[model samples]
Target chain A: MILGRVGRALVVSELVERLRDRWVLIITALFVLLASGISLYGRSAADAQSTVTAPSIVTLSTFLVPLVALVLGHDAIVGERERNTLGLLLSLPVRRGEVLLAKYIGRALALCLAVGVGLGVAAMVLEPGHRAALLALIPPTLLLGAAFLSIGTAISALTRHRATAASLVVVLWFLLVFFYDLGILAALVATDGALSQDTVAWLVTLNPAGLYRTGMLVSLVGTEALSQMGLAVALPSTALKAALWAAWIIGPLLVGAAALHRRQAVTG
Target chain B: MKVQLCDIQVRFGHLLALGGVSLDLRAGAVTVLVGPNGAGKSTLMGVLLGLVRPDSGHVMVDGRPHQGLPRMEREKLGYLPEAVAFADNLSGRQVMRFFTRARGLSRSRADAVLSRVGLAQAAGRAVRGYSRGMRQRLGLGVAILSEPALLVLDEPTGGLDQQGLTLLWEILSEWREAGRTVLLSTHDLALIERRADHICVLHDGLVQAQGSPDQLRRDVGLPVQISVTIDDDAAVGALVAQLQRGGLADVQIATDIDGRHRHLVMETAPDDLLQVLRIVDGAPSSVRDLRVAEPGLDDVYERLLEVTR
Candidate 1:
């Protein structure tokens, strides 16, 4: 459905507020500097006769983009509620669903812009030959950012305190980004590496960050490397991976919106 | 438009925020809700705004039930919360623009409201630097931006000084003149007493009494107190004896601490006011000063609370 005038205005208002926040600016700058540093390192590796491609960008973003997205979105709802502005906003004609959707779209726009600028400039400066692979990496990286943003937005809606929401988002980030792969590895080792290839592929696809990483790697480095590393046995097609990423972005957002709708507006 | 609350009941956890309260807020009039702290005024406002759902009962605005009202219909209502908080980073003008835009209005409208609230000079300043009263003015500006048919204000006079209070009354009067409905919750009895067309006294989550100020006084049966001061002690004693002998059983007399002035506090019905004045004129003592005090909203409020307790 088309967002009405109120929804569009909410998005614009949220964008303006986010752009003015000092923390958002700092995090955007950090994304640019870090992406540039990674691109420069890849260039040095290329100078040493090693090939650098989209997998290099994916590895950096597997850690950096999710953090930036989380920081940008973790307080989207709870912060407004805690600060007493949500009451004023909800008192208007806008529905709770519109507010939540507008916030997600607004933050998503900022995340995409930051990631595009950071990676776009870096690709131009360091690896002009591999610019196409870098460009291919941007969409999956953005999907990854959107996925984490959805999770953070959900957590924000479930809590009333900003500190509590921030803490929960950090825990979620660690579990999905850092611990998921380690848990998979420990499971493989405990099974004496005898787990079926299909099982391993399904497990890898379950984590959004892992799905993003593998999707980027297969796109840029071909399926041959993934097969050799035993990470691509039953790997689905590119369309399937994109669909999964979309699910990750849209699913939690709907759940969060429902939760927000069920509750009363914050008041003093 | 008129707003009607029908047997509205709300409970938060174990605390009852509102009992089965019914009220009719008429159009083209200002309804002042007076109550003690924690008397469910805020919760009632929330119910009216559709922010807090009632456990039982519903509200009807202008003829349609609140839930049945379309988004455009709901947009015709405006609300000013007890504490006005905005994005501190945004300038006052930007805050207004944000709200105006959210309601599908233009920046020119925002500018108009800023000027209307007398905040045009400080429009460029960040809200973080605004005083409490200035923030309230900004809140007022936002509430009136759409020229809503129904305006709900919660303690709109909380941080206002005398001038701000006067300005607020002027705005309310203008809105009433425009044939819009204004529902406000306030504890400033002296300020709202003369201005409210209807007064609803709420206590302990119940509508203890609701009427026009005079109607409430009549319902409560509170008397008009007439205090007469006499400079001479002998005249004070003689007037007290004469009032007693005149068989004015409802009149109670007491001397001031100086024992020079006699206070004849009488519970006279409205019809007897003239007779009471004549009696005082015919008394044996020369009345140095006479003060007639009618039971106002404050007195009605206190009496209701005391009777209910």
Candidate 2:
């Protein structure tokens, strides 16, 4: 049979393996619970107030998305290679690129399920009346999750040791999710609240997750409130803005697939 | 032909892992690649399985080239690496499922393969708890799951104990009886001596010798050792000297046992036994036990190595 037909089976097997693993399952559940708790607390705090300036859904998603991405992706390829299963995968007629793509899709799907569970619970508890509003965020959140995993897959493929890959991913996550904001804050401080619009536009574009978070916030708050918070910095006309974000998401995936395609199963 | 490698050369940095290695495997036969460490056994297996690309030459499956063939081609090839690491987080069933999917087999079929590998009881147990031999057997089970046209294994008996080895040999023998090609690389001389049909001796990144076991023994020109018991060791040295001097034999003293009953064992060509007996007539009561040492693949391999060196 053609491998493409078997692709879903391979992916499902990976999903099952991930689900069966005690550490991964426990950690994933804990992460879901943490996201659920944060979502509930943030929504309650926002709703208890008489005003609805900023949605706590955006706050919770932006934090939880990267956390989930980092956790799910950091070990996918390197860990498999380290465990020596990568050679077994390569020995099969499956292309290296296909394995990478299948794994990324499989883990992203599992993470999406977790995100659904977490958000579903949070919505049931805090935003039962805003089900439609909460449901609107799922697609973009899934895209964000996929994008981060693609980057993580590429990083893992390039490193031989899992610990090194995890350490590097940790540093990368800190920079992209946390340190990049600090750098922007430093730049903002240096400019003495006189930051040029173009500089700020480029800064946000440099971090794909930041761009995704910004887009999610804009979608939730509407143009007027987003403009009030200066969060809608240079989001182009809607069509162009969507294309830019799409590029930000798929660019890493394309690069990752290319890298995976050229890699040989040489590690023993 | 089940698998064919033609003039393949795989180089790793400055090291040439396989230099112009070529061989063919036939169905229902055990083809053993025997060599010392770093003799390109693993590299050759990797090339055949399409896991490693050679710097030169091509691998053909059945009659067609293997490269660029879709994954379906690989589904017909089963491989067991020398050192196998399974998915630790997965249960044995889950791990088998991965290989089943890779081979495009049913999940139910996977359970059957796991059972065949003696992993039925541990099917639902995590692979992290499996012993090394269990993991190796699991790997073998995965390799043979599809009943592929060809099976490529690297040191399949590396970590197996006597019982595990015996069980694996039985499985391999059954596979052989079913008209499947089994191309295995091993340093276990005993296994090769007992099991291999077509033997290839690889030395220093080259094919040093290739033939069937009997044919290889002849080609290697190994000595025939004879253990003959004699009554006295006093005349053994002179007997050896007289045999050498009279152009009677190339006899070498292998052992000299001294006790209330003394015996001496001499190794020589099986054809020269009559001449040796004539030379030992000086000690008429010397003869007791006599047996001809059967030539083995190890002797063949050693002679081949000596000639190449």
Candidate 3:
């Protein structure tokens, strides 16, 4: 069957498996520590301190969620293939696309939980005005992690071995999370600031990480901060940015499904 | 349900994994596919499961042609691969529940299959703690969670102990009684020969032979062995002489490995078995017991492969 129905059982199992993993516990603990550490030292009587603590949480997740997401999803498909469960699973009513999509959703949910609980407890330390803002940081954090999870699943599909998937996902995480903005900065400097502000604004939205940064700045800090950051001219609207985030989450799953189908055809 | 894989041909580039194969699987029968490594048995199973799309021929299920078995039809099939793997972190019960949900079975069925497979005690244990045999039993449990009409198993007995084998036989017996179709591929021919209702032997990407056990033996025309116990060792000669006088001269004394226990053994064509028995019966007082060993399935399979080779 082509594009058959997704198996909810599979999605649930993937979620359960991820939740049971030791690495998930470790990531959650790391988030707890990071959120607590940032909130512990940044507390103040004034409500203006909310921006400082909440933005730090978002920034930390921006740095850490991709790593956790890639770690969670790197084995989603190749692990099943290596274990030889994929063939047996396909013998059921499930299709190849269904399995990949289910893994994506399942792992994404686990990451969402990690972001929720890991940073959620810190809301007790902050004042009422920004506690909601601190909570608001979670949705975008999950979106950013979900985009990486998509890329990780696709990497799992394209590679033959888990070792290869692990390495490839790390390389992708490094390039996208650690070096993407840096590369963009280098490109802007190479042009001697000759690049149009509109072009730079459009270019910044191409990366999911960059788009997340833009959305966070606009939502929390206002348009004045965005114009000061020099990406305010002709930046994408919030709806378009959400669509881009969704595209990041879904496009790679499609590519993973295609790769899965082609591999079965050639190898069977 | 009846499944017909007609004229199926699958090619991976220039190497033909399955070439012009047609197989008929009937209800209430255990049809076994036996072959050497790389004999296209797995490729054929893959086609049956819709994992491999045949380049040429189509599949017909219950007389309706299909590109392959449709997704809805696949729900009727229970497949067990050679390597049965599951999420190690999950408990055995959780794994079964997952499959139970995937098959759209009732919630209680997960425990029911665990009980049926003799895994009720270990249901709460993590699957990583399960032994190889337990894992195989779990795989079988998952395969049968839906009680599918057709079961396709690859190397079902790989890691099974004797008790596991007995449990499997019991399940297969139930399937037979229910008139479900079962197809399995294995290297253990001698163990499964008597249990299987029909045997299909594949060689070099083609079916060498397919038939009931008796039919294959008859087609191969292998000799039947007759063993007789005499009252005394001296009667061995008398029986031999009596058989010689009765025009059945080819007889030898069969001895155990230690050469202490002995019996008069003779070989005859299956058609001549009755006549040979009559001749041996002619010497009545000397004979204590008698038995006839029909040609074994492995022998017939060997002869068939020999001819093809």
Candidate 4:
């Protein structure tokens, strides 16, 4: 319980630091403006037969959330280390694991407030009648943000330089969010639709972004959308998607925390 | 509380940082670790802070093994690392509050410490605006916030001005007087000579010598040098010849630029200082001026380092 109290204090301190960071303010403002602008534009375009809903917001977040999370979390460990403050922090009574956990949770909380409040405001303005849909979109979006935060934290732990961590997070983002589905599609085309359904299922579930996208679509649109494409039977169930998301959040974080715990604080 | 390091060894890649280094840091005294750069002074402090794990040894804090000390017990030890940097975005007050809260101390304690370090006026200003000495003072404030039993600092005076240095000395003296253990690493022999109760000379990753300043000079057999200035060069030459004939092994006579004033310099053991003085008193030329310079921490440090090398 004392350790927990210390962890909470660390989280509070981290949040205070982040709140004072101009870059965090800029990022939050950008997200709110972008999301609200998109929602308003979609509302006016309803007469043109185009509509935006919870799934549209989820699609937007698939790209936006990971970008924000990566930017916020990539420097969590290595930045402190490079700035020479990690030694001072660790010199206190808190354990290394507490620091890592508190850092992740604190950064995640900041991301959640930004994305949740930003999207919540946008959803209220655009979909005042669809309260159920708006509520359903929040969890998956936050989960997706957590996935990337954890991944970025892992990158931070593995690298000792902020530049290296930033670069690796970018590469990882491109691979998981942008290139993953495209690569799967290219594979299907290259194989002339001969790729096994099980192989396709595994590949989609393995990518956190892909898993989030499919889970959101299946939850909002139901299995009928998959069935029409003859892909429903091959896709993972909603439970499996949730499990994969949980795994994405936990796996890298545990590994990163372990690495950080074993690391020697850099001394002059 | 006392800290005992036992056969500590640390290696970084192909380099050996510390090898079989052992030290006893007594309670209620100021222990200064002095060494050249890369002599593993920082590494040893890091070990004591639990920031660096030894390769094959252990540290004991107040007779308890370092690993056996719980987080609550570790809280009683404070550390100020060399050139420590805080978040530039946070104000000095905010930074102190963060650390105080992290140590589970209240916000009032943070304010108390800020005032103690004379940072209360600057507490509202962001740390990015702080000068080097101000930042070092803030670091000291954070280290002392918990009233730690063992306070460890590495190069704490690196950026301090004369006033800041004086303030630091006063704080250290207060801590020592409070029956707390103060361990610090410094290259400033002048400062150490005045404040250190125990001095450890480290070189090549090993302890060269360890003792009080006086004990060190005595053990090293460094002598007090007595310089006598005579009214005339001829008298100085005569005195040098007489002292050389008198079996004074270390003696030199040098005429000033005008050739009118000459200085006779002699190095004698502490016990023979009076004998050398009597010899000078009985010299042919009456001494115009005389001065005695004892071997200080600087001399002892250099001699010990040289001998170990």
Candidate 5:
């Protein structure tokens, strides 16, 4: 339904709006500077051992991209509400699901563009061999961003106030991106072997940020930490991780659609 | 198209927005819902648009019942929201083009409607730069872009200046002449009392009253006023006697400060209007000037509110 004519209209509208928005511009600029700076710095210490330093760049993206994606998309619905345009929009032939999908597409595209251009520009500074690693970061980073955007849009739909949505997404960003793995480790320690390694790894899989970290470090052949925790054996192929990411994206989208379904009509 | 709202009731928490409200919108007529703030005017329009689901009700368009207007029916429906807004960065032309695509209208219809609303000169300017009236005009442009059979506008005149209001009124009148059904809500009593063909006075989620403007004015049964100026002081008593003799009571007579020219005022019931006029007409030699003041829709609405209180 979101690929229909009306859906195309809303998608193009959101794309144009996001492109022209000042906040989006600022975030994209910040991402570019950070990406190029991190890549340049990662090159400084990586003269040996795989010789590419993709880990540092992946780590940077694992933290930065999701944060940026959430900040960009956390207002998808309530922002329209505050602008007093939500009623006019919902009154159109478009459904709430179409609007949520449009916002996700528009924001995901913007976030992906930032990831590409930022890393691509940084790739120019790297040796020809290492540039491939920087380029590889783009796909997974975009997947990570796409999933966070869905979560952000879900948060946007679940709340009525713009400030509340914004604050909630930030709190969630911290919980997922920064504290998720640490909390899992803490849980394992506190449980005194009660939580199995498979159970612990499954908990990590639930967090997009943790799953992305594990997938990147594993594919880069950096299993020093995971081997110790039995996570190296527990986690399998990139394809499985990729499917999980797809779930992360689709699950939040369905949640957002459901929230919008339950959304009440506003009064003047 | 003819529309019927069958006992529409909406509740927000414990507060009932519409307490079993039913209304009929006849085809080719301007039916306005008039009420104060929180009187559920917008909510009622929301029900008609199929945006808000009533607690228990059915909306029928052209005799077909619907939970919400079907896609085919929604295509014929257009709406202009209160406090209309758009993406601030797009030019007015671009905004109209976007709506044109959403409504699945021809691409050419966008520019045509832009110029029709007189936004042609400023069409290339971003919406942020447009004044409230211009933005409202753009909203108007979007609503009529589809030439919808049923056009609903909520508080369309809230922030408009005189020119914007004139444009709105002109379009509404043209739509009425062309037999398009229009529904709107407003609180500007004086401005709308004349423009609406049929008015529904809504208060506290109830359809307190509904009818033609004249019918409502008569329904309220407010006083019909007659004012008279006497050519001579001696003729004042004769005219008052004639009016009293003609089954008219409550004649209030007052003389000028010079105690020369006399003025006579009378307040009578709706049924006595013709009799009051006839008596004043029969005393033409003594009555130098006569004026009749029929109760306006505003007065009728005000009287209804008083009774409701």
Candidate 6:
């Protein structure tokens, strides 16, 4: 479609501009490297007695990839509006749908490249057997990153202020990454290791990061080991995890696109 | 023949961006929309560009509604926004190339368009380094690309030097001559009067008036002033008597110069003035510079805006 031309131009232009901003690009690349490095080392330490395998690499991605996804996605909408380039982009023949779709697809593509580089770095630092597992993680990693970016885009579309959007994103990151764990710890303490069945079920599966963790761990350690850790029953199976990832990514993407379209109607 | 908006209405929250606005843009004719800030000029432009949808009514380009306006149809419609901001990292040439490619034009066509806009010299320069006027010219160049059938310009003359203004006017004139409709929204009334074949005055979210410059001035029907300077007390009394006896319409003495010398000005037509002149003197003495000054477009604009408000 001719409308796709605008999308292509917009993506190419965004990529070129981001590439020219060396400091930001370098910082993002470095963050990916550091996160990948941390995951590779942590996995090796956790598996000291056993040989690292493809599944072990999947565990590393499940833990570390969310961090990269959150950072890249939260700036999508608010940043363009802040730069005052959104209006210029809208004035083109490109429909608002195309613009949103392009932004989502383009950012996802860019993130894929970054993740590829990061995965390569992780492979380099990990045991040779872990490479296949790391490769297996790419699809979900991309979906997870897309989900976070979509949430960020939704937040951006909802507000005029980029700082406000960024702040909310940070709060979300804290809740997903650290506060969920804190809540789980408090629940465990309150229950004296005898929490109610429903309470335990809810806490373990509340966060997407937690889902990624238990799912990847179950996939790695097998059903029997997952049961010993007291999580196989509470956590969803690999199939359910796959479904959640799809819902997490697709739901927000649709919501963000709808919001963007509505907002454009109001403003334009 | 090219574009027309029929009783368009656009509401922005509590503000009426365009309230029952209508316009007709004919092929090969340049119509200028002139108004002050917040007068809905830009809103009308936006409607034509299909960026903003009207609350009611429709925008038609060549007998087809804007919703039905095909991409191929709009490929012939060139638009230069009030102030365009391109990618800073890309050269002006690159920016032009991107737009041309988007418009489905060849790379060589983009080069020709850039050359037409006088940007060929600085084609290699980054758009970040372009001055406001140069950027404006580049925007116009983009608007003219693909040899568009309709060119919609929003404040195209803004930030341009006198020479640039002349060049832009010449280019616009050429477009008009080539049977391409040009719709320009500007604050430059003088330029509109000079270049636009049709002028629309927007005020308070409505069209205050629309017509040729002379027709608008005539419809406003401003008063013509008659100025006179007399010698002393002797001539003052004679002038006043002559003006009164002349039986002119809306006749009134303006000033008395310290009970002796006086300056009298009356509102009367030039052709209707010979009777007053014959009464003032035997032929044409004592009275000096009996000039009849009719209203211009500026006066018409002020009067129309004042009455509408």
| The candidate that achieves the highest lDDT relative to the unseen native structure | 3
Task: Give the winner by TM-score.
Answer: 4
Report the candidate with higher DockQ, 3 versus 6: 3
> What docking tier does model 2 reach?
medium
Interface RMSD of each: 1.8, 2.3, 2.4, 1.6, 1.5, 3.4
Instruction: Give each prediction's DockQ, rounded to 2 decimals.
Output: 0.54, 0.57, 0.50, 0.64, 0.57, 0.24
- Separately for all candidates shown, the number of backbone clashes (residues 3 or more apart, or on different chains) is 0, 0, 0, 0, 0, 1
Q: Where is model 5 more than 4 Å wrong at Cα? A: A43-53, A192-195, A228-230, B229-265, B282-289
| Tens-place lDDT digits, model 2, residues A1-268 | 3237446666887688667667656756775576566555556555442123125556656666776676677777777777766767777776677777777777877778777776666556555554566666677777777777777777777777788877877887778887897898898998897887656766775576777767766676566775675656676666776776677556766776676566656522
The local distance difference test score of model 5 is: 0.82
Per-residue lDDT of candidate 5, residues B149-202 (tens digit):
888998888778888888889888888888888999988777887789899999
- Chain B TM, per prediction: 0.89, 0.85, 0.92, 0.91, 0.92, 0.80
What docking grade does candidate 4 earn? medium
- For residues A70-95, write the lDDT of model 3, one tens digit per residue: 88888988888787787887778877
Query: lDDT per residue, candidate 3, B173-193, as tens digits?
Result: 889999999999986788787
What DockQ was computed for model 3?
Answer: 0.50
Candidate 6 residues B29-133, lDDT tens each? 888888888898877876666666778888887787773234556656777777666656668888788777666678998788788777899998888799988
Tell me the TM-score that candidate 1 gets on chain A alone.
0.93
lDDT of each: 0.81, 0.73, 0.84, 0.82, 0.82, 0.70
Better of 2 and 3 by lDDT: 3
C-alpha lDDT of residue A150 in model 4: 94
lDDT of 2 by residue, B1-309 (tens): 456788988888888888898898888999999999888887787777666778899877668876422366776777787778877878888878777766667889998888787889988888889898888888888888888777888788867777778877887798799988888888877666878889999987899989899888776655566665665666666666787787755665545444434444555565676777666665556667667666877777877788887
Global fold similarity of model 1 (TM-score):
0.90
- What's model 1's overall lDDT? 0.81
Worst 10 residues of 5 chain B by lDDT: B66-75
Task: Report the Cα RMSD per candidate.
Answer: 3.0, 3.4, 3.4, 2.6, 2.8, 5.5
Worst 10 residues of 2 chain A by lDDT: A46-55
Per-candidate TM vs. native? 0.90, 0.88, 0.89, 0.92, 0.92, 0.77
**CA lDDT of B129 in candidate 6?**
90
lDDT of 6 by residue, A1-268 (tens): 6347877876665555545545446755774666566556556555541235445455445545565565556556656566444644565677776777666666666677777777666655665555566666666667666777677666666667767877887888778777887888787898797876445655666567776666666666676876776666666655776787777777776776777666633242
Clashing pairs in 6: A54-A133
